[model samples]
Target chain A: MKRGWIIGGAAVIVAVFAWLLFGGLQKNVVFFLTPKELLAKGTDGVGVPVRLGGQVKPGSVKWNAQTLDLRFIVTDGAREVPVHSTGAPPQMFRDGMGVVVEGRFGTAGVFEATGLMVKHSNEYRPPKPGEEAHEKYKTLIQQSSQ
Target chain B: MKPEGQLNSSSDRLRDPSAARPPRTSIWLAFVSIGAVIVAQTYAILTSPAEGDMGHLQKIMYVHVPAAWMTFLSFFVVFAFSVRYLWQRRENDDLLAASAAEVGATFNGLTLMLGMIWGRPAWGVWWVWDARLTSTLVLFLIFVGYLALRAFTDDTQQKARWSAAVGAIGALNVPIVYMSVKWWRTLHQPPSSPATLDPRYTMGLRLNAIALLLVMIYFIRKRYEIARLERATEHMAEAAAMGGK
Candidate 1:
């Protein structure tokens, strides 16, 4: 009887913890905002960390080898926001490709990117479940669950 | 204490109730406490002042920090009880360790998810091999492996012993995971502990952290109780059948 109580008590604890951690509906739940949403929400120094999702404008990319500064324009097909970044760019960051940049709008309303992430168009399979970088997570699960 | 072979019977009956009566109100109190914490956390995340730089994404901090706290805290519980279980061979201790390990895994997984979401914009990459991030990845995987081992083993006593060992050893990585940022040249930022944040934000975050901690404890307790109940039900059924025989 005592043992049974212990087990039941433990289960309740886990469930309660999950609820407390994630059950709340925080308005800050981050979502992928479309290009239209980004444009509609004009960037007037709001400093909202936005995942500006759009295609890199074809003719707008200019790279300065000396400074390693990459200048590009992100377009929502209707409006374009100039992006200035100083960092090693990801491989997938290409012209006319979909990308998300994290940063706030500059004083001139350009989307000055502090971080850049590339998105893949291809869907992933199960044994691979898609992410090439998820191997570390899989390995951890394997060792601990063993 | 007992030989390896003799562990089977003891393991099989690990859930047998030693309690004359279950403390039912404790479970309800746990639920109410968790609910209250959720409310407080939600308010903080939604109504908190936007940052001068990150704006709304700054709010992600509320969720990110608590999830991180739960992940580490749950693992700590697992480590403590696991040691006790191994040293004293107490059934309750073993169960507590297992329960905490499972909960810890869940919270750790959530932390990773929230981190990824927060990272997409903040780091410009969905994933990175930074020291802190990589170590956390390992921690989560270890927990998953621990749970898997529990599922794989059929013999109760053997399963408990094996898992207890895993829980104890696996916890060694928690501190390593936390310190990975300091130890390695990584992109991830180190934490600003309670003493670091600006007063107002610090107070709010600390309050939320405490609320989340309580919530975590309640969940661990409830989970432990449910497992106990299930075990009791099984034992009762077994005993009734034996009487019929």
Candidate 2:
């Protein structure tokens, strides 16, 4: 009976630790913000690490191979913001794709990128005939109001 | 309880003559220490200074670092037990090593999962094949292989000797995994405690790590004791079968 108590007690302790470690500790606190949120934060260079999330604006990227400095523009459909970064581009870095750059706005009102992360959207795919995402959005809206 | 069961006596259980000694009190100490560790870790996470950079998300470091540290510590036990079993050919030591390997594998697996969870927000990717991450992955797989081998091998002697040999070889990777971040350019940062760590997080990390270490040792000891009991039960069953024949 004593041995059973010891084993049972140990098992319970193990289970509690497991629950705390795996269940509580393992769950991440995600604070994702859309481009509108970034705009609302006001683009003054505050020297704080805030993420600027948006798609790279079409035909707004310029690369300087000599210094490896790159300049681009990001857009949230409502506004456009210029960004600058200096680093080896990640393998997936490209144009017209979702990105989340970690840094603050520069003194010149440009979004300075200290670190870059490419966001892979699940909805992104090759354009199909009448399969536009906006069409799905419209269809859902029309069905919901009915 | 009095040691009444004759067939399950420690003396009869040992196949080798020199394989007879009382279990160490270190196992009990190891258990008490783990309880202390869990408490200390909780305290650190709650009261420790928030990092200037990461804020409250830094609290995850308390749990993450300790689990990773214990993974390494448990594997060191596996290595020691493996060497002892190989040298002395003791069934008890082999059992201890197997138990450690199983527990170490469990913790290592947890470390990776927790790491990925932390990494996703911090590094913005779920996983990358960096030095520290890849080597830890290898360590996890090796111990998992150790556990798999133990499950399949029924013959006690064969299992002991073979598993010991594999365990000894696999133990070589622990140090390599620890050093991989330094040796290679990796996205994963190097050791965060007692090394080049931020001053704010150092003491908190150390206290939490000590507590986590204690907890891990306790779990491994309990597992080893259960394994020994199972072995004893198996021995009794075999003896009963032999007597009926």
Candidate 3:
């Protein structure tokens, strides 16, 4: 009877722990927040170290080679956050690519990113025949290197 | 002089004629699996075209993904044998579970190292505290704890029972580690599958997984054999001491 009680108590404790890990502490477990979620936080989102993840807005990328300033807009369909970081992004970084940037949202309305990470999809396609794969990224690489 | 005498007797018992020798099949398996891994890796690198985005860096997937898969596979074996040990109260099952845990821990460490290598070039960071990465690290630590418990505990039956519970519980983290990306907002990409991966990369991934599976099997079998011999020697030493008393 004592053994059974001990076993029962362990099961309960494990169940509670699992629930807390997967359920009650979900917000803490999330590695990043979408722009829409961050925007929803309003003032609470500003000046706090957080990760903002979303697709890079097409045609919104502006890299200043002279100053090493990278500016891009992160969008999650509903909202967009303009991110300003000072570094060469990953080689895979491009317009419309999924990305997660770590930094604070300034009260001045730009995300002051301390870190920029490219998130690649699981797909791995080879360059099609008669098409050069490296050619497409050559300009971006050269620009970043300069 | 007394301790040295005890050690000599124990070594003699380790070479007892009654003890079973490691099977010839396990020896062949070790060589065959090692050969297969080399063949698979060479084939993968030589045949697969440069990826559209990451170029040749995509080749790292062949080793990294298979190592991670084998880590999960080994832990699953540990979980299975652990439960079996608890239910049947078999010493062999306990030994088998311990062997698998050691192999699993090895693959787990390899996976982390290879992932870091891939992450540095691909993710712009060598490590992250994301759900997937953190959970996998936790899984590795749990098994490390399981192995440590086995090493420190001298009471065979008690050690087996405690390890069985720990091993079973530790393995429960495997699925959580796998699903962490899907369940949480993480920097790590979702799990790669045939449907998600291009047709070109699938063959390489499959071959590498098979080769690694064979290697994992060979390792478990070899380790189990050594564990059995160790246990036999321990029993013999205990019997001799009791007889002397």
lDDT of 3 by residue, B1-245 (tens): 34355456555655566643533345789889999999999989988999877889999999999999999999999999988887888888999999999999999999999999998877789999998899899999999999999989999999998999889878988988888888877888998888877787899899999999999999998899889878886777776675565
Docking class of 2: incorrect
**After superposition on all CA atoms, how large is the RMSD of candidate 3?**
4.3
lDDT of 1 by residue, A1-146 (tens): 74465457556755663453356412222233445666677644347776676778988887665566888988878877788887556543556666667787666767788877654332211122233332322333343345
Compute each candidate's TM-score over C-alphas. Answer: 0.59, 0.59, 0.91
Q: Report the TM-score of chain B alone for all candidates.
A: 0.85, 0.85, 0.90
DockQ of each: 0.04, 0.03, 0.63
Q: Where does candidate 3 stray beyond 4 Å?
A: A1-6, A134-141, A144-146, B1-25
Task: Please give me the total number of clashing residue pairs in predicted model 3.
Answer: 0
- Candidate 2's fnat? 0.01
- The pairs that clash in candidate 3 are none
Error of 1 at B178 (Å): 1.1
A4-27 in candidate 2: lDDT tens per residue? 653475467567645633575333
- Candidate 2 ranges with C-alpha deviation above 4 Å: A1-146, B1-35, B193-198
